[model samples]
Target: MGTIVKQNKQLYKAISENKRFSLAIFICFMAILKIQYSNVESTEYLGIADTKEININSSHSVKIRNIHVIPGQTVEEDELLMELERPDLDLRIYELESQLNELKAENSFNSEMNKELKSVKVSNNENMDSPLQIKINSMTKQLIILKRKKADLFVFSKRAGVIGSINVKVGEDASPFTPLITMHDSAPSMIKGFIHESIYNKTYKGQKVVVTSISDPNKIMDAVVASVGNRIVEYPVRLRKSEASVTYGREVVIFVSKDNPFLIGEKVQIKSFEKPNEIMTAHAQAVPVRKIEDVIDLEIGVDIENTKVEPSGLVYIKDLNQTVMISDDTGRKDRPYIYTVNNSGLIDKEIEIEGVKAISDMEAISMDENGIIYIASSMSEKKNGKVSDKRKKLLMIERNDFNFKAIGEVNFYDALNKVAKSNKSEEWAQVLLAKGNKKIRINIEGILVKENTMYFGLRSGSKLTKDQFVLLKINDIKSVFAKNAIDADQISIQANVAFPIDSDFKNEGVSDIALINGELYVLTVNNTGKEGGRVLKTVLADPSNHMTELKRFKGLKPEGITYDTSASKFLISFDQGDKKSKLLLVDKF
Candidate 1:
């Protein structure tokens, strides 16, 4: 009976130990749940916010007198950025005015002389005897030009933003063609993220989310959903540090708190729930998330049936949230025009330019911060034996109250050719020209202005490669504008690459280039073959790597590319190659 009692006690002890073990395991399991899949925390969508840069370029070659704002200072729109010392400009204006006044006095004397002569039938026809009046009209036009030149001397900030860089100082000469500074928009930095498809429904616009630094756990912040993408996209490797070999997900764009102390390009974690708006911060929280400003919805990409622009390109005007597309349509009768449109693809107004500036086969277009539009004219031709004008020039235009007028133009032909030859493109170009008895025209397919530099994508290739190999050359816009020739020291050739990210990719040359927040995107096309077109993305920070194909764009021969920040999509135009040109929008951009 004693033995039986001892065995019962042992059994009870074993049961007690088992219960303790079971309780400990349950505690650990619950702790892991709180850490990993907490309803309040999610690591699915993660990214960092970055501010966009606005380049401010000088428009005239003049001596600067005073610099108003220093680096890191915020400036209002139209604020005086710098003052120019132009005694010569003032003297020229005065001289023109003096000439005008003298001509007016002479005209008054001539009128009296003509009246007396007409009474006697000596000078009956004023049209034949109005040399003085012609001189007076000429002087008046000269005076107007001198006054406009004087106005260009006083430079102003194009938009309200924080000055990030200052390349020119007081008492120095600044040229209109070169960038003098760059500014960061006054708006807060933005984070573009991607969410796993499994939890994408838990993410949405206006949803409240927490952003925690992956590098520093104590650095916590908040963000609000600005946009949630509609389609699944390839996960950008830069957005996360993942071990997964294959990655695809939906995207979300968030506006980080204005006061958030996160560095640009740094990775962070984002946690979101179903009811995003309900999770907004309560009153006592430090660094409250700023309400996202209502970004004007510029209804972009909804194509209007009869609007076709060939060899086309368009740029976004951020200050006004407007879009301007200039056509290179060389008509047999009239000059080409610029098309300004509203959000609904309705052509608002048309501005006609002179025939000479709007030359035939003007392929590429870009814009500056001062609202100046630059259109590239490919005037070079292969003649009987030599290259005629072997260069490209720019047509400059600026907006007036209701229309746009050709402000001025500066030659960029010598600059572009010099850069191309320096990059070793000249010899191979000659070989292509020699391949056939017929004259082969070399043309620039696209142009992009990024900060202080210009990227030109050439359509014709060298060494009998034609479209198989593309020649890309970049010019320091400042040096190109400051001097008529591209600085030989500043030219760099982009590496020729065939995007092989997809299994069925073809060797299409680059047709266009667009830089978004320092990340470069290229439009590639194999127009002669089955590979129609595609857009590729390359991280500027890691340029040595091959460009990763972003999306296969089946649009009709898309030849030009630009990004519309307000719409958050890439806008492209087709050459249509003798057909009606069309515009295509890529929402997955």
Candidate 2:
């Protein structure tokens, strides 16, 4: 009877332990849920806002008389920031006015002489039509223009801001091209975020917000809206959720503490304390990351007039153990030439391309197994929106006895237009070709030819789709060079595969693309002041449009990329504006 009692006690103790363990697990699960909810509640919509840099420029060439404000000094609008003087300009004005008065007096004398001659019935046609009258009129206009220069002698503050720098001193000549002083606002550092039109009514002056750094969410501060824009403006390309589509929003300036630690031009997020999830998200949910493990920098040894060549395309030659590169800019003194660079990044030889006058914006180069070479142009509009005929060409050349000769060449712009029309997709192609709402200009930066197929990578996403990076594919591209294929439809569009990401920023585009071991690789670059480059890889057979980012780099404007078998790695060539072009050997990604 005693033994049975003990067994019952032990069973009851085990049950109690099990209950305790279960309760502990339940508490942990609830804690995890609470943490996740807290994160979601704190999430904010992304935007870019920074302190505005205002430049104080010289209206004309003038000598600085005095500087009233020092660096980091605060001043009001219309206040004196600097004083300028120009004795040379004053003397020129005096000279012009004196010339004008003399011409007028000479004209009056000629008129009097003509009147006397007429009264005496003597022929006076020469005096009446004398050139003195014309000279007087011209001088008077010139004197008036010269006198206007006096206004620039006394420079005033353009706005109420803080002085950033004093570029000129007393007696120093300042030109219109260089700013005499740089200034920024004195107001507490604020964020200039864009809110959609739909949420415009929800936002108002004095609305409370939680500001967070896009790069670091841990850095957060409480802020309030200072002002709301009266009219809606288009969102910037980098802040837009869909770069291929147009979006409008009202600019909202949120004032944060003066001691806030946000850098200028750094992108941040602004969230209202209430209704955090009510507004539309402007930027992507994921932040940009640099995936490159290490970057190897190399300098170009050759120089052109003390400036290095701007390399735009690269291709590896296995037999020569060297790489062939092309420059986008060539002088009129010489024809476009392909440069051969050794492993040490020194130019070994220059092979001039025959039958080609000049190349503009030569972006990509590829070579086939049979020693045939192909070079592609950018085919995009310039900043002024005009397309260059020289940049819209594609050339094919062959090497025989170390001499390169042109085999075939075509205007790729017209060819693309014809193919679009034949496919009954001209409407979509027009959007890609032009610049307007929901349109991205065609900027082909990368080209690769494999067997009978050719692929072209667009710097901006194609207009055919709204959210995918596009590649223009053509079948039998080489058949156009055949004797009978001149009038044939050998260049019909075959397909356009899409990449997953469309985060396009201003001046950001695909720098290059390469086909290695039947896999396609893309390199995206940003030439602006922010963001570096991203390398992405994906297979052509990826029906689901899966893309994997392999590497990222900064401080280099990568313009060309190629796979080198000898090194078993990838080489990227950079176009350093005004500086020498550089070569980067990337570690295996």
**Best candidate (score: TM-score):** 2
Candidate 1 contains a number of clashing pairs equal to: 5
List candidate 1 stretches off by more than 4 Å. 1-308, 333-336, 353-357, 378-391, 400-408, 418-441, 464-475, 501-507, 529-531, 541-544, 577-580
Candidate of highest lDDT: 2
* lDDT of model 2, residue 414: 64
Per-residue CA lDDT of model 2 for 1-589, tens digit only, reads 9999999999999999999999999999999978745534422456665665767776567788888989988887679877787787888988888777787787777667757675565345655455775576677777766766676567787446789899888888877668888988654356888888777776676455667788987766655566689999998888887889888988887655445767666788887634344322223242222123334333332222112467888888776667888887754433467787644454545577876766677888888767788998888878896667788778889876557778878777766655554444443455454433333357778888888667777765345443345566666777655422322244333235444454543355567888777787777776344547777787765523567778666766778888778867687787777766677666567
Per-residue lDDT tens digits of candidate 1, residues 401-433? 445666555466554544454444344334333
Cα distance off (Å), candidate 2, residue 588: 1.2
**If scored against the real structure, what TM-score would every candidate get?**
0.43, 0.45
Q: Model 2 — which ten-residue stretch has the worst lDDT?
A: 281-290
Total backbone collisions, model 2: 0
Candidate 1 lDDT at 104 equals 83
Query: What is the clash count for each candidate, in the order shown?
Result: 5, 0
